[model samples]
Target: MSSERAAVSALFLLNGLLVGGWSPRIPALMERLGIAESRAGLLVLCLGLGSITVMPLFGAMTARAGSRSAVWLAAWLTAPSLLWISLAPGFWSVAAAVFLFGGTMGGMDVAMNANAVAVERSRARAIMSSCHGFWSLGGVIGAGLGGIVLELAGELGQGLAVTAVFAAGLVWAGPRLLRDPPAPDQPRAPLRLPRSPLPFLLGIVALASMIPEGAILDWAAVYLQKEMGAPLSVAGWGFAGCAATMAVLRFAGDGLRNRFGAVRTMRISALTAMSGLAVAGFAPSAGVAIAGFALAGIGIANLMPIALSAAGNLPGMAAGVGLSVVTMMGYSGILLAPAAIGWLAESFSLGAIYLGLALLLLVPLAMSRLAAAADFGSDTAP
Candidate 1:
């Protein structure tokens, strides 16, 4: 409702648009590059690698320059880099382009989230979930528009170029609508990684949550199409259902957390994740799998945002630095999920991966108490 809220929401949308716009076209990109499926997977890994490597550095930069300047710089870097990656002429070039693109995305992610934390603190209540809701909405828009562009123009490059332009336009308009943080010239303590173990606990919770989330994103369609004999056209419904549910629920997450508190929310959500993935893993029909994926989306939707909020607000640390550490660890889980699942799929089954990740969600369930205590510092968990 505030200008800072509007600006931060816009940036969240921009990030989602850029990332989702390119995602639907990945198969085409690999085909263009004459790369095998395995190699394409590796290239995706490179993107995550780039993001993880640079997140902490960007966090420090955000600390020094304030999230305002850091976000603007990220916008500038992201647009052109996305365009370049879309038009890459070869596999290696695509790899390099995606690395840069991922770095900028990572930078934007930290800066924008840091900004969101500031905005939330200014409001003195919960709003992070709503901010993330806008991101989910943007992903829906980007994916739908990207799919349309593919149909109309028959070139992923053109769609991505258009997305890049839109992202740049948003960047140009952002400062006008958004409130700025303190000036970069303001004297502040230099950024440092957290020394306390609390952030690590938060990061572990985030890592556990992200593995299943990423697995659903990267493999849901594959599981439906290949394992269940669903039509290729319909296989995407698994992810679509998940995304739709996630969007809706995240908009409501703050209210739930406010009413029930983080610990109970975490516990219920993790149990939902476990059940949903288990259902999907053992599903006999594509419809059931899609439904399961939707449930899983509901479960996983708010955990990352909640973890991030907890991280940024951790006592006795700079917000940006604390956020970056958790983000890096979470991204590691995301990066590991797809590649590790793929490897396991060679010998085991995608269903096995789903079930494995489902079991892993318990780690967060176990850690939810820690998250509650760290953030609220109360026995509000039960």
Candidate 2:
């Protein structure tokens, strides 16, 4: 519980809050603009693009510049991106801003993970899950506030502006908040590429894990509205149900991880996700599908945090690079190829998409165990 760890954890929470706060407003924004569902999806893709662009580059940026500068810059950058989304004049413009926004988010993630690992190493205990739990708290606040703010004027743009104001506050405080420099007790380790077959296998697993999340975030409403024929007002219940489950599970994740260990927690979580996906995908009624998503959310809530903690533990590279690579791969699923999932839904069925993602989780479940075997000394995975 060093000040450095506290600062980074706060930053992590801020990022989650920002996402939850802004993301739910997307449909509102689209409606305000009078755009089609498919087009709105494309615009939302821009945030992914921004994130994807930064993921691959985080390692080098952290290595050359150090955490204080890179991370603070990233935090400041993120707040403004919400404004861009708020003011987007056209689909492409929003897409570009989102791409840049995603990049900042990616960089922030890498630096935060790296810093978290360093703190864990310093403290010599398990804390990553607790830190992540804070992120869950942030999401709860973000989603709640985002919902409230957007409801005020029932205006998406104003919500964006308010979010931007929050971003500005983060920017102002960032310098004072960031660790002055990331100085590991161990001087710079040589950059060993995570060629471990484990990383490659794990990357795919990360992608698969996110597919369900992407679906929850992007497609659930549509599925309820178009497929289940639920009323427009009720459509959002699909995401709300899923997110609520995720938020609750994530808040409790630290307790679970400490009690069961990352490996056991992950294994159980995977099973939950698989079962939830199947139930939701094939449900006969909208209520049933909502229940299924809740199950899926509970299952998935802890998986990503566990996997990310594993990446931080990999011995070869600095935690920053390891996190960057894995994070980049995971976000790639959302940023680059998810639109294709939309295409797939168009041709196939939404049920097909969930099933495909569920099947994909098995790969990660296997890798999660492998990663567990390789994990060093329950030494509090960063």
Candidate 3:
């Protein structure tokens, strides 16, 4: 179990590392292609489309093959796909590569979360938050280190380094992942949409939580670099700062949820995140904006994990099915935000978009009760 947990954690980290490594390069990618923010956003949208397209199929695959196989398959595909983005010379080529990256990433996201649910169920405890914490930790390393490497090695070098590290991690974690036998009753279809309001509502909560997160991941550096006059080399730290605090709080989130109950924890988290966004949106300087992002991280850290836990435990639904539905819905925020925010930012300001996103938190805050389902196995659930 311990080895399995470690392996899952490593998978989460590697997944995050890939994203983190990519986040810092968005500005450079835009520069290389000589594209406007709107065009870059459309390119980013391709990523979300790819992910959304593949998620349901991956969900079914996870159900039919067991999560370990799904994880390995996605991981193998995901690692090398980064090179496609790094090397693509034109807009169409980059879009195609990003779509492939998003597809693989979406597959891995579903598989790994399913694996985390299995691990949590076996222990009859909450480790989902901690697993995500390792992801944030990886983001910190990826963004922080990636920025340095980008300055020294350029885009291709950074891509190679990230891919190499991910491959090495895969080699180490592959055999250690927990392998569950495929259930005879598992769904074999390529896609299965949610039939219940429960998954949709949970997905809404997850979506609300993830939009800002995706914004931060995809745009925070650009926000810092273009708006605040931060150097390109250091702009990545905006997200690095956010992921740092997110990692810390997420490591502690399971305990908070176990003790305070998921509902109360969610309420507080929503408020904190809202406040953080407001701060960032209104901040006069980059440093303050970074601090605000960190604060937002504290609030945003455990939201999707808790929602995912609830989805996994939904009555009458298979874990993979429920996870896939909610995962696809939640990730839609990532899909939607880049293009929307790009258009909106082109019209208004990025700060305005951040401010607007802060208000969107009310939806999740009002729906906090839904998170109570996350406490399915907890003795301290309220």
Instruction: Give the alpha-carbon lDDT of every model.
Output: 0.73, 0.67, 0.89
**lDDT per residue, candidate 2, 1-382, as tens digits?**
6566677677777776776565466567667767766666676576677777676566556655565666776777676666767677776777777778778888887776666665666666555665666665565566545655666655455455556656654654465444534435323455455666655566676777776777776677667766888754555556666667786787687677767777888888888999998998998888998888878888878777777777767765556666777777776775555556655766777777787778877866776674472235244433
Which run of 10 residues does model 2 get worst, by summed lDDT? 373-382
Candidate 3, residues 1-382, lDDT tens digits: the string is 4999999999999998998998888888888899878988987898899999888888898888888999899999999977889898888999999999999999999999999887887778888999999999999999988888998999899999999999999999999998865545775554557668999999999999999998988889889998999987788998899899999999999999999999999999999999999999998999999999999999999888889989888777778888998999999896667767776767787887899999999988999999988988443221
In candidate 3, the residue pairs with backbone N, CA or C atoms under 3 Å apart (3 or more residues apart, or in different chains) clash, namely none
Model 1: per-residue lDDT, tens digit, 1-382? 7767887888877776676565555555645677644676666677788888788878887777678778888777787665677677788888898788778888888888888877766676777777787777666665545545655665555555666666676755577544445534333655556679988888899999988876776667667766899754466556667767778888998888888887888888899889889988988899999898888878987888888888877766666777888888887776655766655666777887788889899898988876563245222221
> How much does candidate 2 score in TM-score?
0.85
Residue 308's lDDT in candidate 2: 71
TM-score of each: 0.89, 0.85, 0.97
Off by over 4 Å in 2: 32-37, 144-148, 155-165, 168-196, 229-234, 284-286, 373-377, 380-382
**Model 2 global lDDT (CA atoms, 0 to 1):** 0.67
Q: In angstroms, give how far residue 331 of model 3 lies from its true place.
A: 1.1
Q: Over all chains combined, what TM-score does candidate 3 have?
A: 0.97
* lDDT top scorer: 3
Query: Cα deviation in Å at residue 253, candidate 3?
Result: 0.8
User: What order do candidates take by lDDT, descending?
Assistant: 3, 1, 2
Determine the C-alpha RMSD for candidate 1 after optimal superposition of all C-alphas: 3.4
* Candidate 3 regions with alpha-carbon error over 4 angstroms: 187-191, 377-382
